[model samples]
Target: METVDLVVPVKSLTAAKSRLRGAADHGVGDPKAHARLALALVLDTVTAALAARRVRRLLVITSDPTVSLEVAAVGVPVAPDTPGGGLNPALERGAHLLRQNDPCAAVGALQADLPALRPAELDAAIERAAAIFAAGPAPRAYCADAAGEGTTLLLCAPGSALQPCFGTDSAAHHERSGAYPLQGDWPGLRRDVDTGEDLRRAADLGVGPRTREVLAPCPHP
Candidate 1:
C-alpha cells in the first residue's frame, strides 16, 4: 500500500464559502454564520481524511492563524500558504513541501469542503488511483464532483508534476491536461458543499459530526 500524501487547501473562514451565503432561499445570511459553517466543513473534511487508510500524511495549507490552530488540534500538520497565488498555488506549495519531505511518495490535492466524505470512499479512491499509476500511461488522475463539471480530487504519481488546474470547470481542464478521470460510486467524495442546496444534499448523504453540529440549529432552507 503506497501511502498518498493528501494536501487540502482552506482559505480564511471569513473569506471562504462566499457563494454559499444567501445561496439558499433560507440560507445563513449573517457573515459570522457563514464562517462557522465553513469551519465546520473544513473540520469534518480533515477528520475524514485523517481516518483514511491510504493517506500517509494529511496536510492543510492555509494563511489564517485560526484555521491553523483548529486543524493543529486534530493532529494534522498545518503548512502556511506560502505562495499565496490562490487555490492552485496553495496546492502546489503543499505538494512541493510533501515531495521535499518524502521524494518517493505519491501526492494528491483534495477540496476542504466535503462534509459528507467517508473514510472508506476516500480509501477506495486512493486504491484505484494507485492501480492506475501502477498500470500507467497517465501520470495524473482526478475525480469529478457530483455536478460532473468540477473536480473534487486530483492526484499525481511520485515524481510527477502536481499541475493542479482547479477552478471553474476544473474537471474538463484536468482531463484536457491528460489526467485520467477516475469514475466510481464515490458520492461522499464528490459531495462538496458550496450552495445551500449542496449542503442539503450532503446532509441527505449524512455529513460528519462537525457539519451536523453546525447545521443543527440552522436547518436546510
Candidate 2:
C-alpha cells in the first residue's frame, strides 16, 4: 500500500478557534477553558490522523508552546512553523521538510479543527488519491469541507508543491489551482468545527474521546 506523510498546522491557542470560543458553554467566558478545548481539538485530530493506515508519518507544524509540548508527548513529530507568515507558509515548510526525507511519498496538509475525524475516512480518501496520482496530469487533490466552500484536506503527490491556499472559499481556490476534488461520504473528515452548530454536528457524528470528555459536562449549545 502506498502511504503518505501529513502535515497538520495549528495556530496558537489564543489565536485559534475564535469562532468557537463562545459558541459552546464549555468555555463561553473562560480563556483557560477555551484553550483546553482548542488543545483537545488538535490532540483528537492528531490521534485520528496517526491511526489512518495510509498515513506513513505525520508532522505537526506549530509555534504554539503548549501544542508543541502536548503533541510531542504523544510521539508525533513536531516542527516549528518557522515562516510564521500564515497557514500556507507553515504548511509549505512542513511539506518541504517531509519531502526532504522521503521524496517519493505524497505529502498532505490537514486541518487541526477536525475533532470528529475518522481513520477509515482518511484512509479511504488517500486510497482514492493514490489512484488519481497514478492516473497522472494533476498531482494535487483536495477534500472539501462539509459546506463545500472550505477545504479540510489538501494532498500533493511526490514532486508536486503543497501550495496551500487555506481561507474563505478555499475549496474553490484549490480546484482552480488544478487540484482534483475528492468525492466521498466522509462526514467526520469534512465536519471541521468552527461554530456552535458545527460542534453540534460533530457531536452527532461522535467526536474523539478528548473532545467528548471536554464537552461531557457542558450543556448542549
Candidate 3:
C-alpha cells in the first residue's frame, strides 16, 4: 500500500470549537476552561492522525503558534499557513506541501476536532481509498460527519484541482464536487464536534484518552 499524508487544519485556539465557547458564560467557571477544552480536542485529534500507519508523515496546518504544546511529543511537523488566510487557504498550503514532498501521496484533509477517532479505523478507510485510486482514475473521497449532515474527512490526490469541501452541508457539497464517500468504522471520522449535539454523540462513541480527560465526564449543556 502507498504511504499517505494527513493534513490537520486548526483555527486559532482562542476562537476554535466555539459551540462550547461559553461553557462558562457567566460565573459558572473560568473562561479559560473553554479554551482548555478546545486545545484538548486539537491535541487528541493530532495524536490519532499520527498513530495511523499509512500516514507516513503528519502535517499540521494552522495559523496558531501555540501548537507546540500539543504536538511536541508527537514528532510531526508543523507548517504555518503563510497565506495566513482561512481554512481553505491553510488546507491548500498543506496540499501544496504534500505534493512537493510526495508527489503521488494521497492527501487527507482532516478537521482538528475529532477526539473520538481511532487509528486502525482511519487506516482501513485510507487503504480502501488507495485501492479505489489504484484501480482507476483518481477521485476525491469524503467521510461523512456524525450528524450525517456535514463532511469530516476529505481524501484526494495531492494537488488535485478541486479543493476540499469543509463548510455547511459539506458532505453534499463535496459530493457535488465529485468527491465520493468512503465507508469506515471510525466514529471520529463521522464526528465533527460542531455543536452540543456533536459532543454528546462523541461521548456515546467513547472519545480518546486525551479528550475524555479534558472534557467533562459527559458533554454538558
Best by lDDT: 2
At residue 212, candidate 2 shows an lDDT of 87
Of 1 and 2, the candidate ahead on TM-score is 2
Error of 2 at 212 (Å): 0.5
Give the per-residue lDDT digits (tens) of candidate 2, residues 66-179: 999999998899998764588888888899889886787799999999999999999999988889989985899999999999999999888888889899999999999999
- Candidate 2: stretches off by over 4 Å: 24-27
- For 105-184, candidate 1 gives per-residue lDDT tens digits of 89999999999999999998988888888898688999999999998899899889889999999999999999999988
My TM-score estimates for the predictions, one after another, are: 0.95, 0.96, 0.88
Give each model's whole-structure lDDT: 0.88, 0.89, 0.74
List clashing residue pairs in candidate 3.
146-190
TM-score order of candidates, best first? Answer: 2, 1, 3
Question: How accurate locally is residue 9 in candidate 3, as Cα lDDT from 0 to 100?
Answer: 80
Q: All predictions: root-mean-square deviation over Cα?
A: 1.7, 1.4, 2.5
Residue lDDT tens for model 3, 1-221: 47678788877777777677654233254557677767778888888878888787778876667765467666867887664477777787787787786677777788888888888877888888777766754567888886676877788854455377778888888888888778777776678787766766777887777767766543553
CA deviation > 4 Å runs, candidate 3: 22-29, 82-84, 158-162, 216-221
Any runs in candidate 1 off by more than 4 Å, and if so which?
22-28
Error of 3 at 54 (Å): 1.6
